[model samples]
Target: MKNFIIICFLLLVGHQTVNAQKALRVYVVRHAEKLTGDPKEKDPELSPEGSERAQALAKELKGQKIDSIFSTNYKRTKLTGFPLADKIGISIKTYNPDQTKALATQLIENAKGKNILIVGHSNTVLEIIEAFGGEKPVKPLTDDDYDYLFTVTVKGKKVEVKTSRYGASHHTEGGEAKAMKSNK
Candidate 1:
């Protein structure tokens, strides 16, 4: 009977460990710099510096076992994620900006126990982050700036947030981001 009790305790501890390991790690970033041109330019491509930054971002995330990638259906976002996707051997999945909250929730659910990356616009990045219960607001980004990184960890129904910055050449690092936390 003592042996049975000890075995049950061990099993319970092991189960908790397994559950902890299943938490998701999601990285959300704004699209890299774009070419300087008219806002109405059709299908603009990334500038030379933007290309370099994209390559750098890709290198940073290489070998990270990214299970899936999400991007807006826009040229800049697509280009921004290209290098990383190529490195990870996964195709970019486009999500509608209007349905960002719903899509973000679904992505979190689908990517549980895995690592996922998302490329979003300046305005919508924070919304998605908040949808996941992140504490930090999305930082403001300019046309030439793209450095924000939001890391979300989800365990069961709880989510923890960590914010980091990359691509610092274009923008200052670290600023107060207003997070709009909501369960919706």
Candidate 2:
């Protein structure tokens, strides 16, 4: 009878351990800088500086096992994630910026136990972090703030968040960005 009770106790603890071990790691960043274009050029490509930064970002994440890369359906965001995707040997997947919550939910569900990278805009980066139940709130980034890299780890009920900078700096101010590239 004592052995039976001990066995049951062990089983309970084992079950708890299994349930507590679900984890996910996510790396997110705003897209790199974009070239200035005509007023009607709503989706501009990355500037030369932005391209160089993208290469640097790829170098920074080379050793990490990135299972997936997601970017908004815009030129700048796609351009930002392209190098990382190439380094990791994964195709870049596009997501709608308007449906951020849905995308966030999909990642938490389908991306559990995997390492994922998301390229977003400055205004939307904080929202994605929050959608994952991450702690702390962050203000929106500026035109020249291209180096913010956010890491979010989710383990069971605990969500840990950290910020680190990567690549070069290119700060711009005044007026809205055109092409929805760097600023959109």
Report RMSD for candidate 1: 8.4
Give the top-scoring candidate (TM-score).
2
Q: What is the Å distance of residue 40 in model 2 from its true position? A: 2.3
* Residue 147 shift from truth in candidate 2, angstroms: 0.7
Report lDDT (CA) for all predictions: 0.77, 0.82
Highest lDDT: give the candidate number: 2
RMSD of each: 8.4, 6.1
List ranges where model 1 is wrong by over 4 Å. 1-21, 173-184
TM-score of 1: 0.77
Residues 1-184, model 1: lDDT tens digits: 9999999999999977786658888888888878877879866777876787788778777877888888988898899999999887789999998888897688666666888888887787777778777765544555444766778888777888887666535443454333424679
How well is each residue in 1-184 modelled by candidate 2, as lDDT tens digits? Answer: 9999999999999976765686788898889889887768889999998998888889888787889998999999999999988777789998887888898778776666778889998888988898889964456776667877899998876899998777764322332333334654
Candidate 1: 10-residue stretch with minimal lDDT: 171-180
- As for model 2, its CA RMSD to the true structure in angstroms is 6.1
Residue 176, candidate 1: Cα error in Å is 11
